[model samples]
Target: MSDVAGTLPSTRPSFLRLPYLRWGLVAIIQLFLIAIPLADRFDVQRNGQVVPLELVPVDPRDLLRGDYVIINLAINSLSKDLSEGDKIAVGDKIFVGLQAGAGKAAQPVVVSVERDNAGDLAMSGTVRSLTENEIRVDYGIDAFFLPEGEGRIIERLDTSRVLLEIAVTEDGRSLPLTLLVDGKAFQSDAAF
Candidate 1:
């Protein structure tokens, strides 16, 4: 062996070489952007009303995205008659009125295209795909990110007994709180 020690190559990226002030400014901006949405979600969880909706889980596995289950709420479909302006089109912001169903389950009572006309306990989502028969809404709570192997367990669960506990604001914003399996909280911050 030679007397000289082997020097390892530097692994730091070029961005790391920037001045401290520049890096600090970039970090502050990044944190602000990330915190804004999370702050809203957190606020809803703290003050929003809890609504339990039936869950229909679909298996989703991606190498880059890790594990998560795509969910379809039982309250997704609305058969209510819409007036001339009440018709929800694709990309429209709509409020879904919710009411307590059998055994304290939350069910979608109606879909109101207008915000002012939206009743109490309304949840908001953007209409993804719409047809005369049905309007598909993306409620932002569509996926439950799971840790490692947990996704498989949720995927194999009997969907009838599965419930998604969500927090909804009075103004129609919603944040998913937990996934309940067989009336038990699988992953949750709130009681089942």
Candidate 2:
């Protein structure tokens, strides 16, 4: 067969000329971008220790961002003494050691600037602020997205009964695993 201009068509496969092939490549790239983070979280969930934390649920809805619970862990603020004389400043990476409480939740027992000095149940966090008597940290597990219309249910529940289950890796990386409301698992609609 000849081209409209009476020229023979090139024999080499042109990827750009094949719409399916081009779209397939695009789809594969997107899939990989999504899969990588999910796989990392799965690894943490599979091998890390489960640490339960008492959650202080704050505003659960953002009109512009859809439905999700903003989680504030009781352990977010620790006494400066927990650092054991280590100088802590804003933006410093620190590890908070935890011990099982009388209930299912784990309580922060100590804080260290070094991972080696932290306990077996340590969580990695970034120091957000520091005062003369207190240090505030962010664990990066502060939100739990829920299905549409479910944020209200969580907001209405007793805040004292809410708990967050987190999987903490040895390196101090953490993944929010579940939300417990009155000791029952609260399902989330988030895909990752």
Candidate 3:
């Protein structure tokens, strides 16, 4: 091919002219994006602490998404004494203090806007709403995602007898690790 000056055609854009440089740049970008989620998962799986929470039932479907159990945790509403110091309002970051319950169960003992090392276990959450005697918190571990048709089984489960395995960080944020029914891992059961 020839140009208007009877010269050969140019190669490619100057920025991407070097194959190795172009590929390296793309690889770096991909690694950066992928690392964020991987790090979060690793943090929970490795150093995060585990806390067993009682599960409460709610609708099992979302119109926009599909097949996920809405987690209505038993600890969502707690007593005002758990608020620690002064009264907390909506949108405040709080920690749900827990204590060991009967056999692998964790009970919410208190809720405090500040971190207290005295609590046996603490999971971070945001205050959704509060009242004189009660506080509603959102722990962000509010959904249990499952494969297609699997959520139906969870929805039908008696939540009063179900327990959710949550991994909580020292700072109080938590992630749902598993679902257990009657002290047995739900995944191992054929009925599930």
Best by TM-score: 2
**Cα deviation in Å at residue 159, candidate 2?**
1.6
Each prediction's RMSD to truth: 9.2, 4.0, 5.1
Which candidate leads in lDDT? Answer: 2
Per-prediction TM-score, please? 0.77, 0.80, 0.79
Off by over 4 Å in 1: 1-19, 80-85, 189-192
Taking the tens digit of each residue's C-alpha lDDT, what string does model 3 give over 1-192? 645764656677787878998999999999999998778777876667766788785656766676777788888888887656756889988777889666667878777767873275798888988778898888887787666677788778777768888777777767887778787766421111
Question: What is the Å distance of residue 41 in model 3 from its true position?
Answer: 1.6
Please give me the total number of clashing residue pairs in predicted model 2.
0
Per-residue alpha-carbon lDDT of model 2 for 1-192, expressed as tens digits?
655755768675787678999899999999999999889887788888877798877656777777888989999999998999898889999999989665489988899999989988899999999888999999998888877798888888888888888888898888788888877788733234
TM-score, candidate 3, is: 0.79
Cα misplacement distance, residue 156 of candidate 3 (Å): 2.0
Steric overlap count per candidate: 0, 0, 2
lDDT for residue 96 in candidate 2, whole number 0-100? 96
Q: lDDT per prediction?
A: 0.76, 0.85, 0.76
Task: After the best TM-score superposition of candidate 2, give how far the Cα of residue 19 lies from its true spot, in angstroms.
Answer: 9.1
What order do you get sorting by TM-score, best first? 2, 3, 1
